[model samples]
Target chain A: MKKINLVLFFLAALVAFVVNAQPPRPAPTPNDTLNSTKVLKDGRVMFSIYAPKASQVTLSGDFLKEYKPIQLVKNDIGVWSYTSDAVTPDVYSYDFVVDGVKTLDPKNVLLKEGENGYSNYFEVSGPESAYASIQNVPHGNLQKVWFFSKVTGKMTRFHVYTPPGYEKMKGKLPVLYLQHGGGDNDASWSTVGRANFIMDNLYAARKAVPMIVVMPMGHPGAGFFMNPGIDEDPYYKQMFDEIMPLVAEKFRALTDRYHTAYAGLSMGGLQAMNMALFSPQRFGYVLPLSTGYFPPQIKLLEEKYADALRNPEINKLKLFWICMGGQKDIAYQNGLNCNALFDKFGIKYEKANYDAGHTFITWRHNLEEFAPKLFK
Target chain B: MKKINLVLFFLAALVAFVVNAQPPRPAPTPNDTLNSTKVLKDGRVMFSIYAPKASQVTLSGDFLKEYKPIQLVKNDIGVWSYTSDAVTPDVYSYDFVVDGVKTLDPKNVLLKEGENGYSNYFEVSGPESAYASIQNVPHGNLQKVWFFSKVTGKMTRFHVYTPPGYEKMKGKLPVLYLQHGGGDNDASWSTVGRANFIMDNLYAARKAVPMIVVMPMGHPGAGFFMNPGIDEDPYYKQMFDEIMPLVAEKFRALTDRYHTAYAGLSMGGLQAMNMALFSPQRFGYVLPLSTGYFPPQIKLLEEKYADALRNPEINKLKLFWICMGGQKDIAYQNGLNCNALFDKFGIKYEKANYDAGHTFITWRHNLEEFAPKLFK
Candidate 1:
């Protein structure tokens, strides 16, 4: 009787924590009642913030073509707001510029972490966004792995996405070294880029292969990207000397050329192209999104890699795909120049235009399209 | 040879992308030039924000008792500023209240994510903080694991911390099911609580047994805690029916009672206490930090578990440690009452006073002290 009662007591205690405790709540203020973002039924997004004493407020976001600041009107209660026109279905980063200062939405907890700062993000939901949206599909695991970097002389962190059923998988899986843009870090691809969700959706639909994606920090710190030239970059050394070996040693990744891929957006895209070109035997697929080499860099590339360009082995890569966010992409001219250089060297490749602009929306679309063609 | 030159070109491209890509920078405004937070040489921290138009600005943080908002002085440049006296070495969360609105520091990127909102945090370095600070020690991996919960009826995510060398370890490790307080989520313990860094430091010093720590979302959504009572709480059902089994299956966790422990803060603390008492044989170590059962709940506990309370096997557990943040803790009275009840029941346990209030600072100290004694 005592044992049975003890069992019942334990079961009750196990479940009781959630029910019993009442934490003290902060004194409610007038500002606490204001909703910061509202997604209307018609697809428009209305953003609001309470700052009665402010003289000026404006909204700055990536949804705008050039990140133009839109003025917000203040109401009688000192609440400033702006309702945007029906936006396309996608996730976009934004911030409020109040009296010349960049400010995050106080009401929105979801943030897009960048290298130097952070901004808030919201999704305009629709069928088009279903690929990257959190759905009913089995989810993957995103791990924040920190390792000491010999190249950087500091602890470097990276996000690794292991697909669903990874823990119980029977064998080693193909690997994709996915990277973010110049200003973003390891967290960008998984959070703002929604890479894991995209992969989860694709895998659930049987449109993409199950793989492990490693998203490493692109730049070491602020202004790290400003130092021109590949030889001068610490990430270059870190990738080959530290990151790759660490991933291979830590994860059950298939490191052979036929099972490996490299891909990135913008600056990351450039890195991807370089890795495939430099170590032609290491990767089966290469996808560079919304990025290309300058004409001078292309000329230097032709002069420097003439032998590798002419080598028949360079053609053995399963895919050398170039993706762009159409003509509005900032790197369109550079991409065209780089493609011309690829053509001049008789390099065979596939290119696609996914969207408009050098942003996550385009990159998400690029991944959605390019991922299905990999590891075949 | 064209092949060799192509290889060199690829190498150049791979390394060059980091060098060559110039992402467009946002036009710098006057607000961009001001530093938001400056940790002084004397340990006093100065915070500044460019908000020329705002009439009033105040700082709200956990460092202050009862979270009193500190008023900031506006200078000629319309910059609002505040200088805090030397703070003891610890991490603290803060936010700027502009006029009537709660705002984030535009200059600080590191944020502590909560269930409903986000706040920025800063660290004051000292010997006391060394244990939780990032040191030159082998780090562990923090993974965001999402799984479908039949109990919650949705996709539930939890943060799992696998200790250093876990991948190469030969045997299954003991598991600590750690939880955060109300209004916090799975990310809080790793971010603000510094649970990973604490474990890393402890492991490096050989003071604690290496183990896996799982921080699950304590509440499903907003106000889920207000529903009151164990039978009605979804998390109670979710914890036993789904989360525990999922962790054991996915992670290399030893499911035996001796290999399991439960700990939590505030509401989570109450839950931990319940788990240990309810299922006395399941967890060898039980820690409830800054929390206790209220008088009414104590009456229920006594009435519901009278037979189990009399059972002697409860005394066989290795450790039942209770921790509090001294008298200033919100739950101090309830903790005292709960202790009296434990004494009346002749339950053996150790208790510690770690700090002065109900916050992460106290919890961090409590974890640092309690972890070394686990799985012994």
Candidate 2:
């Protein structure tokens, strides 16, 4: 018995030695470092990049504001990292310039198409970010719908945001026809503006009524809205004829003008104004955020229907809200000129202003304020 | 009169000279060279990266095959450009190694998240790439749907692809519960696999029936399906209970098992196998592409359902399809082992093998072959 026990003990010791000596599970590669854009508990962000051979890497972003690009310090493991100063609570675009080559954050998956190229974006959460942040509230569902457009003679796509329990809801819900800015498509509102999250948070707080928001592609063809003929605009004709009918049939949406609202930003805002002016009885509320009537548009509106602005039918509108960023915005003067024209025509309208330039931040705040006052 | 004519001529010349000498439009900046990953007409790709200060730049991609990284020549404008050999028609992921740091193509908006990191992707169109290529056929719509999952206790998202005219279709449509690989989410099928294009092409050619493809988030909680107990898997329970019911109610999906098919790749394939075994009558067709049973998984299945393999329910499955790449694939042996086990149990299954290794190319071919055989 002693001899057998001795042999077993030696065998077990050899097996244990082999298991323990099996080369430290291979050291982690440089990519193993999960040091990417991490939001700190204090609301500051920590950005990191693993570039072992890079001589220099600097971080630049709109969140830096007027400040210069922040330089990162390299650690012994060749991962450069930088903890930002407490940033304001909002979504911000950022990029890294590695040895004069401007590139996006490798670790950040969320990207937005900017004037230049695609930039990585992150949301810094705080009290002010509640509207855009993912809260404990019940969330809505977004559907990407593709429909054939007779006006454009091509298949077009749009995004629809249905509120929580929309499927099982008892009756038809009111609709908000939202549109995106100049260079953006229908996806911009939800992806960049966080429109769904904002609506969910507001509905959870009882600050906004439950409604379906439809974001259609504003620029169907080339050349923005510079296409000379108003009737020939593909998106405009499609919205009324094809899009609205499809939305009503496919979704449980209220078709009455009293249950309808229209809002947009920049070029989309211009389109919204045109849509409302062309069909005044289609929408009860018209909101043009961060955009207003230019000289040519105002002249055309005056030429077409000067009495509509002064008549009781216009007064029958639930709300005519206009909002823009601060005076620094390029469109601020246009907003003021349009307001003056409304004043001259004795048209009652509500106005709101924010202290920021023309950006998604301004548009999001505008939506938060504008949505609450709609369909009352 | 001669003197006045001379003066006018001089004025005209001066104005023309001023217009011509407009400072050469200030030299193009690095960002102005929007020339990264351009596909030439002859099926070759031209890759350019703006790394003015970098010492070295090279293009690396699967398209290069066994060749070394293609060295890029820098032009006087500080942009590095390289024209690759005529590549075979397929979508390829690539990255630029600038000064030894691997980075994605900054100008390419299309990206795919691999096991390593995010990589830029470009399509090479040709006859062989028909299933993945965008043809003139009527396209389907992709919807991103979010629903609450009681198993995970979180709002999980999935992507649904509805074929052309699905909205106006008269009857319930068959559903394919497609799942992505380990590192990918619900969007992988549409974005990376080009599943929508594949279905559109197949349907246009009358090679496949019209159906809805639903891709759910397979990895519900933490880890990559390695959380020990298989019965306690969050995604497995969610798919049968919450996901199926929600999809059935929201979309026009046929709830019968005869119309239902299950398919996935790699880790997803493992999960599909688990689901089919757990509820043998739930899916009429089972497709495990580029993945199959390993020793441990086979042992677990044997312990749980040794008699199920010999039973008639699994044998009644409409199709038991197994596909993998050539011998070069790491999972080829796994496929063989699983096949041998099936043979021993007298189970019938269809097998397909391609010449390529483990990649999206192999998976795409497998899907093209497998989809036509489903819901027959």
Candidate 3:
């Protein structure tokens, strides 16, 4: 009877070993445990960094006035964290200055390349910033297309966004020629502006028509749009002649002007104005966000295209929408001055005003408000 | 006469000031001045970090045998730099431990996400590492595609690479189903492996056929490929049923076994073996790099598909290539054992060996050698 009890005990121990032999759970990674940047529900942002040995850490960004650097306090676990006041809905770029060395937030992956260096960015969004937020809706496809640019004498790339159901549903889709700001390329609109998500949510709510959006690089060479001798007109010509034709041929894009629109932000805004004023018959709708023509540029446009602006056949524009941020915006006075000039030329236009100033939020709002009003 | 002379002197001074008024040159950023990592022409790598404040710095990486850390010396410019002895052609991940705190290369952007943290990676290339090097050729387009996976029940994303001239080309292209190793997503193969550039150069030299490469996530949920509950068969099924069908429908792809190939590295290699054995009819060519079936796995495969392996009609494989590093590799013995099993079963296969041990260079060399033999 004792021998039988010993055998049963050994069997029970074996079962316990087998049960405990399951794979061990993986330890949480630093990215999983650390909250480097968190967007609170109240539109405030909390930034943290792991620097146990460092004596001091500070945060600096363009969103702050005069680019002031804010100090952070250390916690029990050796993490330095700082919470900012309730900031408005906008994408902000920042970096951690640890012991006087500018260090990127190791926890944050969303980075933007700037003139000086790369800056980590986070978005503070609420109902007011709904257009840029991800919603429960069918998303569109963002494609990278590479083509030879005759003007640039090199291979260039552009991003094309085909609306949801574009593959299964076969129909000619209208195209929107979207452009990015200075120092950015074709990827800006979809990546930074969240244009595809914005369009997806708009389409889900039936607020906007489903159309293909084409974002092309505004600057093909190493120069800004406002710089002299950049000669953006030739690049624009190349777009209409080569790039647009290729886009239409490869994708299911309509070739007619009535099914085409042009929109851009900042330097892209300037390019859009140039395209509209010069090649008025190429696009039916035009929207220039957060950019306006100065007096010299307006004079140049009037002198160059007096007959086209006066001719109803060539100036058959369906919508000329101009959008800008509030009075605090650097371009606000310029926008007003340009509007007065447009009135003097008897050019009909629509305008939009947002509370934000010269930020992606303002441009996103412009896209949200303008995209729905197009192709009507 | 004195007043006139004074006015002339003042005019000369004003001219000098105007000449100097041209905008001052901006200071160089860390990326411009420091060479955090540089691959010498002779295959040696030099790494530098600008940490003047730190008392000590060391370099640690998988390339180092015994996983030892090497100390770095500080230069006059307050930059800590280290040059390693002639390393072989491969990609390596490393970090600088500055004053006992781990830090990434601020200048280097090519980073690999590991289980614990992100590591900065550098590639060493020469004539031998031709496939991984960026040769002057027409590059392919790397696209990010988002699709819903019914198996995972989430919106999964994958990257697709189309060879140059895919848009303009007028024929159905072959496809290569590529997979990443454990702990890596679909972006790993393209971003880290430089697969697109490899294909571009290969196609330019007419060594390899132009094909569409689809890289999909190996693990669907929160587990590694080797874990028990992470049954990769369903994920492979999803790839064949949904992802491949989508690729075929959207892109110009040939939908036959003769036009399809399969290859993967590490855990992905294990997956490739499983898929090729189970779904032999789906792929004509199979190459498992730096991974192979162990004795137990081979036994299981033989047991499950004894009749299928013996049947010539069902086992009509064009190529069964297995590749791994030298004897130092952890998987080298398993690969040999698997080959012996194949020999016993009268299965024909090709094998290649490299000098390295279970590194990306070994897998890259495998791809370089194997891709040329596919779809010929």
Candidate 4:
């Protein structure tokens, strides 16, 4: 009878373990019950955070003008809150500056990693942001691929997005070599730029041709840039020597100039411009966004590619597009100057501009607008 | 000449933009120059945080027993710092509790997403952690796959790892349906569990047969559990109905029972056990780490499959492995009591236990050991 009682108790303990086992979830504090962010029905966003000991709380995000951080008002219960004016429909990244230290919204799990730090991001979803939002359409597979870089002597990672029905597609796909900015990695375009979702929505809408988007690491090292010796840049060396060949072979990408395209933003834009000038016959489309080379690099390009820049093949590209974020963009003047040089060199390019500054907002818009025009 | 000088000044500004362009690289404060986490030469880790305003700072992580957070001492400049004792070479996740609020280390970019929040992770590299670390071996691709689940009626995401050279593999590959615990998503195994790297190293060393690893979302909703009426559970239904068929069709996976395996941890472990019991002929290998069924569920299984449990076919399973953490593990007693019932039903299984409690540390070790014995 004692043994039977012990067995029953053991069984009861087993049931308790089955019901109550886990690594004890992060205990929520008493005052942490409030939602930190709320996108109101009227397109206004409300931000809140609870920090009783903090002297100041402010909201800094891409939606704000000139990188300004707005202040939050604290209530009696130590929860600070802020309500914004009607914001346009778009995805935005933000961080809460608490007592001079930038902190992520503890209530928000969505994050976008930058070169220096990570920021919490949210979407004010509406019709305008429909292309970038996750829809009920067939989604693409984003592959985290690693390739050994002989130049860098490390296993570098990159991202590849195969569009819907790509696995069963009959013919080889055209490839787009997308590059991130100076302060981002390969994952930036897919995560923050919403490249996958954009493609999915575009495919569902029958607005674009299905293609493989390859995002590779642009910066070889901290200070590596496509400057005077652009051909010798480790990033360029790796892309041309290892990455491009791997993409062609492994992904069965179309290798002809008509099917290959190169596009990038900021520093990556500069790289794309260099790749276009260095090998004028390699890419059919070259798009550079929110970036321009310095005068010295432009001078080097003028001297180095004196023949290549003027060649009629350069004009034969399907698209040579250059875009900037209006006059307020940090690179606006620089881009204008670079275009002036291009005009002198008999280069042909289409230029466009948007109102957003040098941020992912402009880049996301750029991708959505340009991806459809590729492999046509 | 004056115009030429003005043009030269413009060139200087362009070069400055080239050199100093980016969303201003998250302006580092004067006091934030210290490295936030440093894995030292002696295998000790030193953590620092530049929180000048916080009153109390503490470190909480899996390495600390029973989830106890250790206090950090503040320096004269208000920087919180602590040096951990010699830690074994493995990956760890941690967070800084600042004034009772959990905060990530701003300087560290490596992050692991938990159910509620994100934690910064660092690695102490050594030969012992060689299987988990990113070695200079030919790595496989981890694809972020999306499938439409009728049960959940959403575009659910899962992770699939194809071994190195899988693109050119001649035949269909075996698959291990891996799952994360209650407090994680599909990405947890690849990121924190280091499942991809473990398989990579194991394949490189010829310790394990090359196989595809499929990790799916375990929790259908917040309070979803694999309790009574487990077959009707949405997670199980979705996995069997939608995800499995999609994998078989798209991945060209081997569908025979001998090449199929199911393994999970914590809540996922319980789900795996339920899956093995409910569909006894589906998986040849069943490995449930740090988990067991409750007594009522066991009684139901015993009553429903009284003849099936003692059938010789159940004994013909290639591997029925159950593992747990040592005495301090929350599920240790529950596992023993459940095994007692298995003995009464004449079930057979291989059990293993490690010293670490119910944490990823133990599960990682469990994977490193059991994965080699799978699909042999």
Candidate 5:
């Protein structure tokens, strides 16, 4: 009788367990992930920019038809996105023509230099990719890029132009981080100015001193640094985070005030000045061609740069080349004021003036003239 | 009865003569009509390269995206022609990206200064639908151009940049006819160079002397009178027969030398020298930005310019400004040689050697500087 009662109790417990087993956890859903990581069988990369307000969104670039718009599809995030099929491996230029305005993709991390402003760059996974391996050119291997930054949301893109035979070469080449202005990305100097050809020609002719050039994009209205007024433009965030990490990761750049350097034109010039004054420990040389540094917020730029101006280490700057074209009256006048301030601050600097105004001619000439002065 | 029979026979013979009247000249077929008045409708423009035995041909320009392998359709005239409706309205800079290499169009009579050689230009029709109509702004007017030419096959392209208050206000504006180098159309100056903006800004700032500027594109590849390498390039015959005569008929231009003018850079400079020397009565002022009238075949340039070179009617010539940049070794050397030759020849010429190269900066500056000197 006692065994039978115990068996009855066990049976009741088993019955309850069977009735109350929690519903199997729901399988993972695509909507559950915020940042979608999708890999296609063919290997195309995809991302979406959610803008419910944008009536029309088209992806345009070196990838698609020249300036023709690429239409995007809508999703739950109110963001529009599209994925391209596995593209050939090469540096591709692209931009988002949102509505009628040209813009860079907000979601994609890669970017290139604009002819004058900033452009977007894409990397595709494929067997015949030139970008996959450092091209087997007869000379040097491309310096692999890597870095960590606090600015540009973290890892940022940067490239180095190593002199031919830098790998086989015994000595370090002088470094010139040539930057592109706003609306430009990393590839601008090479594409628009044909920097590679220029460098090649100069080196071939033995006219230009051998050097490693670093081209970075300096757009105020980019990523987290976006703003109309200069001081408000938060490129400082990128300067700290993205740019540095990549610089450190890529080429074996010299780590001295004089050995390390920065130079840019227009927005690029402003970037050079910001890098020069804000981080005296990192750079000794600064050539601002047709540009000057202002706190992205003018008031703040002046105030902060003022503090930098008074710093003792600032005087250690090897070269503060503030150059502009005579025709660029606005920039020239502004640059003149900056040069006068540099003089007042006793900053060792040189000012070179070209006959023309805010133009690439002046910038190219400035590079040719000023680059040779570094690490000499 | 005899009289009636004779009369009937006479009527019958006359009727037969009238009925058998020589078949009315076969109504000219529509195809022949179209060939005569080619409207360029299907919206496609033809780029013809007359290479008798070339295996392949292609057309390239800023118009074609990437200048892809545009296959050329052949003609019985041994002309390799390619048609395109792919370009947009505006001055597009391009070249014939022929088989594995780049070449200029053999048919289009337009050119511009490029990296090593001149680039080609093609114009897409504007919105006005009157082919191309000048847009009249508060400060200036872009005129509709039509001209009869003897240089390129038949009708040629030309545009005039006129300053504000010209139609209503009756003062002769010093005319400055700026020509593209070679391979570019008249629209090149307007599109890529933004000639209108340059003038508007200069004039608005009261920096430039207000004047009517004309851009005409017509140059043969042969001699002082034609192409420098006439035999080497096949387009020489087409250019001489078509492009020039049309420009002279299109716009209202000043007839006097002082009121009229001429200037260009590179091949354009060659054209400017050729035009002023060959057609001396048309241009009082000549500014060859970066050119030398010396192509072994330019005996005509020498012959025509010989009188102007010695005891030059300096006062009548207005201003013969010839200048280049200091760094353009080739151009500077050529310019310097010309200066010396001109000096030996007792030619009173105005010249400048700026600290730059034979690039657009120097050329732009040359144009900017020369404009103020015209009819001033």
Candidate 6:
């Protein structure tokens, strides 16, 4: 009876792999995960597997497809081989769907721990990739920004890019407290703006002066669990009372107005004016790119900087740069109006108009040009 | 029957829009389609309907579940209105879900253009914006690279930028051939890479030398339907023979070999070498950022430039600049190998090691630096 059962099991195994009178597939061994990275002659990705009995084997993930992958040809050495062309610029999930069950490639190196079994992930290259900027120049480290706001309680984010030689220097670097527009947090400049890349290139080229950049989230309570009241609350007051102290404590930062700067785009641009005029003590360089002073804020501007608008110390700033998009209407005639007001008050400010609409391209370039001129 | 229907709707509307009433909704209006432009004022959006006798009317879209929306109140003008705090940027499809039946907003400018009906879009001041450099720079123009490639046997895409006063010149401007990386067409640099913006900024700041930049499709047969042969296709040959002549003919360009420049990254960088060295008479300046000479092409290189690799003309043709990524192993080492060879051969060249992985940020910055140096 035992012999008969063994024969029956052998026949079943034969039926599983011997579909077209071909030799039976070899049984998979525990260490079949041995064959690893292989680069094809044409730079294609090649890898080996030991799925001896997988009738339908495919590499499905971010780079490849799911479940049913292209068959990997089995070579004489009992290993299955597959090669793939490179794909897009992000991490993708893939699994070796053997017959029916899903499984990750046992050979890949980069993996993020997750709940429902560890899924396989691969990194595809970016054509004009932001992540690749680290190799071209010395990138500023990204340290987390935490601050307690009186208006929204605790927990805020600011990303700082300190100039090179910052850690060892005795004298503090000048600070540029930059803010992002709406919808974006502290991450916008790094991701889409490629701010680090721009700064790295500028600093390397010696065309721009090096300065510390502080990018803070415009919205407060952004990561709040139950209720994120960031957009609803006006945290301009919080900027003065809360964020400044937190940043100063963390980095080798300049303290007084002479060495401090304020800048932002769109909503953040509106905030730049707010920082310079409202606090009046924290910043020396003021730049509002793409958006300008609001109609309601016109009255307050006179009251806040009545004596200093013309003096290089007041709103004139070290570099009171105001700019707007030629196509954008939100800050449309707003720039013209701001320039007119500055003219009226003898504010002695500088303003430029760009031809395109309001976008990260313009804002970053504005800084790429403006930063070198500041604190010079 | 119509009178009875109107009476029923009005009766339902009173209960629906009492302001803070239970089960609040807006009444249905005569028109269809949401006019977001008008409602976008007050930095807020409002729900409205004209249901004369409805108890309640509501607004709902993909953002909501089961069509539960904030209610509306009946104004003196008979329009039911409910003011909402500004929503973020995205497309939304809302329906009245009136008395149980679903209906869309009639007054929005954003249309349901897709096959799916009832789609409305709005841009509520997001940080992601258009390029401002294109509009601000006076000497630059964003023109399309239109060419019928004899190799690809199809019309390919490219972008051409000429510095200010480019057209006024009696003599032709110096030409620089620039290429984008894989998976990206000519448009990638102009749009995502913001190449035009970078150039615009450089020109605006007067930091870059003004010249004409010609960007071509990086891949073979990208716009065409058929593959134009791989290694020995007559198509690539014709690109040098036919297409180059056509582009030179259409644009007022410097035609001599020393007057032309070539630059690209990765696959593009490889192509730059293929064009300049393989078809030696076509170009002068060669800049391959983060790319090595075609590895396997050493065989072809031996056959073609074997004797001349040691010659001065190989270097003296103009400029030969190469860049490499620090973290990149396969490609980085390959580029270094070629740089070493260039040194051994006494070729005049410049090599910079960028602290980047394979990325767009590296190439974009490289271009920002290189474009200004070309034709100087």
Model 3, docking class: incorrect
Per-residue lDDT of A274-354 in model 1, one digit per residue for the tens?
Answer: 766666677899888888876566767787767766767568889999988888776777789788877888887898997
- Candidate 1 lDDT, B1-376, residue by residue in tens: 1111122233345445646764334455557577787778998888888888888888867676654578999998688889988788888877787776667787777787877677788887889789889888999999998877777577779999999988789879999989988767789899988999999999999999999999999986434352214465777778888888989888999989889989998878878877766667778888998888766678877887677666676677799999998887767777898889889999998989976577788999899999999998
lDDT of 3: 0.70
DockQ of each: 0.32, 0.18, 0.13, 0.34, 0.00, 0.01
Q: Could you tell me the interface RMSD of model 3?
A: 17.2
Candidate 5 or 1, higher lDDT: 1
Q: Candidate 2 chain B: worst 10 consecutive residues by lDDT?
A: B1-10
Q: Which ten-residue region of model 3 chain B has the weakest summed lDDT?
A: B1-10
Error of 5 at B34 (Å): 39
Backbone clashes for every candidate come to 26, 0, 0, 0, 67, 47
Cα TM-score of candidate 5: 0.33
lDDT of 6 by residue, A1-376 (tens): 1111122233333334334455444354533346444544564666665544444545543344221246667665545668878533433444454333333344443332221123334444444333323334444433434334557755444666665444345767778877776534565565445565566666767766767887777766442111111223456656666667766655567778878888887667767665554455567788887766545455555665465554544553667788775654345655676778778876666877654445444565676677777777
Q: Please name the candidate that would achieve the greatest DockQ relative to the true structure.
A: 4
lDDT at B122 for candidate 5? 46
Q: Which candidate is the best by TM-score?
A: 4
Q: How much does each candidate deviate at the interface, measured as C-alpha RMSD after superposition?
A: 13.2, 17.4, 17.2, 11.6, 39.1, 26.7
User: Model 5, A112: alpha-carbon shift in Å?
Assistant: 10
Worst 10 residues of 3 chain A by lDDT: A1-10
TM-score of 1: 0.90
Q: Write the per-residue lDDT of candidate 4 for residues A87-107, one digit (tens) a residue.
A: 889898778877776676777
lDDT, residue A242, candidate 3: 78
lDDT of each residue in B288-374, candidate 4, tens digit only: 888776666667767776765666666677898989888867667768876887789777989899878777788888988998998
Fraction of native contacts under 8 Å reproduced by each candidate: 0.52, 0.25, 0.10, 0.37, 0.00, 0.00
Please give the range of 10 consecutive residues that has the lowest summed lDDT in model 6 chain A: A223-232
Over B1-376, each residue of candidate 6 has an lDDT whose tens digit, in order, gives 1111122233234324433455423333432342423446555666666544445555644323222355667665445666666544322334453333233333333322111122233334332222222332343444543344556565444566666555455677778877765434564555435566667667777777666777766555433111111245443554566546755765677788877888876656767655545555556788887766433444345566666565546655567778775664225755776666666666667877655445444565677777767766
